[model samples]
Structures are given as C-alpha cells and as structure tokens.
Target: MGTQFLTDEKGNKTAVLLPIKKYNKMIEQLEDLHDIKLYDEAKRDDDGTSISIDEAFKIIEEKRKAVK
Candidate 1:
C-alpha cells in the first residue's frame, strides 16, 4: 500500500494518509498483536487453572442436553 504524508509549512510531516483498505488491514494487525500480548500475559500468570478438552466437551454436551 502506498502512503502520503501531510506536511506543515515548515516541511515537517504532521500526519499520514493511507488507503482505507490499508488502514483497515493495519487495524486488524494491531488487534491481532493485542490478542497475542494478552495470551502471553495469561501464560505468565500461574494463578489460572486450565481444564482438559475432554472435560470441556463433556460439560458442553451436558449443557446442550439440559437445554433440550
């Protein structure tokens, strides 16, 4: 994607202009980065307990049966 800079009278770049598609892609990348940081922080925190996949599936099935 191409970028254009909005400059001031002094020839200093003040802002940037990018295509909407490029801007949206950048936003999505930033969100992904944020999610990765959250995951890293969760990994560092030892206080959280994790459940096995089998146990989780069983619990979900039980809930579905109850709803029906």
Candidate 2:
C-alpha cells in the first residue's frame, strides 16, 4: 500500500492511503466525476445512517424543490 497527498484548486489537501489497485479504481471513478466534494457530517454513532441509491435520488429531489 502507498499513501499520497492530493490538493484541490483552492489549495485544500487530502491524504489518501490505498493499494495500487484501489488507487487506480478511485482514479477512474474520479475522472468520471465533473465535480466532487468531500465533507464530514455529524452522526450519532460509528455505524451511521445508510441509504440506497434510489433513496439518495429521492432525497436530492426533495431538497432541490426547497431551493427553488
């Protein structure tokens, strides 16, 4: 496994540690993402909330309407 520091346009930094295969997979997925934001949200426990892809889309739609 290897570790690397990644910097954003704004000079923010992130440290990622992964095996070569995992790193390549991440690179492939990141290349497909036009914009990606990484953040930490508050949670009550280590095993936090879980939602499926369909549920995520529904939540996005609900939030989008409130912004309109």
Candidate 3:
C-alpha cells in the first residue's frame, strides 16, 4: 500500500498520509470512475429524442444569454 497510517495514543488508526503524486493519481481515477457511472446511468435511461450538434449549440447559447 502507498500510505502511512497515523495512530493515536491508544495505537488506533486516526488518519492517513500518502505521497502527493499518488493522491493526485487516485483523485483522477475517482473522477474518471464517476464519469463512467454517470454515462452508464444516462445510457440506461436514454430515449429516442435527439438533436443535431448545431441545434444543441444554439440551445446552449440561448441559455448562456439568459443567464447573463
């Protein structure tokens, strides 16, 4: 394991310490996994309704204008 555990006076685990690079890598992997889960859920619930790229872009532009 790429971690060191911090202990309390009773020798019980309190926290953890790991290299910065390893922590960053773990965070990146977790983000990727979350994206995959979202994609899977979207795919599972997908309907036939769809739009072209230009249409989607136009809708996004309109929403941005409304936000401003």
Candidate 4:
C-alpha cells in the first residue's frame, strides 16, 4: 500500500510499492492455488484451510510440469 526504499549491501536503493488491494488479491490467488494442490495430494480432506508457501510452490511446479 505504501512505498518503501530498500538499500542493498552496496548502498544502492530501489523503491518497492504495491497497493493494499492488489496485494490482498495476490495473496488470495496464491492461497487458492495452494488449496487445490493440497486437495490433490490427499493431504487435506473436506475443506482444509491452511498451506505453507513452500508447499504452494511445489504444487505450482507440478502443475507447470503437467502443462508442459
């Protein structure tokens, strides 16, 4: 929602920014993708509600492979 200036070890700065609404939407999309993968893996049954970021990416990779 707000902008921030990040300084690297070399003291170079870059502005990072995002709108809160957009960020929330991105989070929701990631969560939905994770839920689908968990369901596929049988690690969740009948509407389970939590997922780790790592698990999400693994699922994403699997999905990507399938598409290819």
Candidate 5:
C-alpha cells in the first residue's frame, strides 16, 4: 500500500492519497468489523425470537423464488 499526503500552503498536512486497492481493502475491513459488531449486539439480546437454520433457509429460498 502506498500513500501520499496533501498539504496546505502553510505546509500543514490536510489530506491523504492512497492506492485504490488499499482504499478498497480498508473499506472491506471496516464493513466486516461493522458486521461483527452487529452480531455481537444481537447475541447479547435475550428476546427469544430466533428461527432455526432450516426455517431461515426456507424463507430465503422463498424470497429468491418470488424475486425471480
């Protein structure tokens, strides 16, 4: 990953320039972290409204069929 900094006329660091690949990788990592946080929050909740894996898969398949 390569990076360069943009500076003001007063030589103060203002912004950064990163390789597109590095920027994309950073975005993916942030998204993954967000997913993990959501999962953790859901796990900590005790409202017993969860469905079984089979039932979940059935619902997903039904939705896919409806879309098609």
Candidate 6:
C-alpha cells in the first residue's frame, strides 16, 4: 500500500498520508456514494407528487424572498 501514517509519541496513529492521486480518487468515490445515498433516501420518501419546472422555480423564488 502506498500509505503512510503520522504517529504520536505514544506510537498512536494520529494521521494518515496517501498519494495525492489516491486521495483524490477516494474523495470522488465518497462523493459518489453520498449522491447514491441521497437518491435512495429521496426515493424512499417519494409521495408520488410531481411538479413542473416552472412551479418548482416559483416555489424556490418565493422561499428566497421569504429568507430575505
């Protein structure tokens, strides 16, 4: 493994070190997993309600105005 670790005086693993390429790939994979989880949750929460893009935009605009 192209991995290393930073240890404390007590030989405890404090931090990890990985190649920049590996770190980036890990981050991308985590992001993809997060997206999948969100999609699954949304599907589970679905109520069969549908809205057009125009109505969605209008609701967003109303909410933005309320925030200000």
For 1-68, candidate 4 gives per-residue lDDT tens digits of 46566877887886556788877998999999999998787763535676888999999999999999
lDDT of 6 by residue, 1-68 (tens): 69999999999999999999999999999999999999899889989896877999999999999999
TM-score of each: 0.71, 0.30, 0.71, 0.42, 0.72, 0.72
Alpha-carbon lDDT of model 2: 0.70
Quantify all predictions' global Cα lDDT against the true fold. 0.94, 0.70, 0.94, 0.82, 0.95, 0.96
Supply the TM-score for candidate 1: 0.71
Q: Where does candidate 6 stray beyond 4 Å?
A: 51-68
Full-model lDDT, candidate 5: 0.95
Q: With candidate 4 superimposed using the best TM-score fit, by how many Å does residue 11's alpha carbon deviate from the native?
A: 7.1
For residue 55, model 4's alpha carbon misses the true position, in angstroms, by 30
lDDT of 1: 0.94
> For model 3, which pairs clash?
none
Error of 2 at 60 (Å): 0.5
Best by lDDT: 6
lDDT of 3 by residue, 6-65 (tens): 999999999999999999999999999999999899878879686777999999999999
> What's the lDDT for residue 19 in model 3?
95
Evaluate model 4: give its TM-score.
Answer: 0.42
Model 1 clashing residue pairs (backbone): none
lDDT of 3: 0.94
Candidate 2 residues 1-68, lDDT tens each? Answer: 46666778887886556688988888889966634323232233336567777999999999999999
**Cα error, candidate 5, residue 47 (Å):** 1.8
Q: How accurate locally is residue 33 in candidate 5, as Cα lDDT from 0 to 100?
A: 100
Give the backbone clash total of model 2.
Answer: 0
lDDT of 5 by residue, 1-68 (tens): 57999999999999999999999999999999999999999889948999988999999999999999
Q: By TM-score, how accurate is candidate 6? A: 0.72
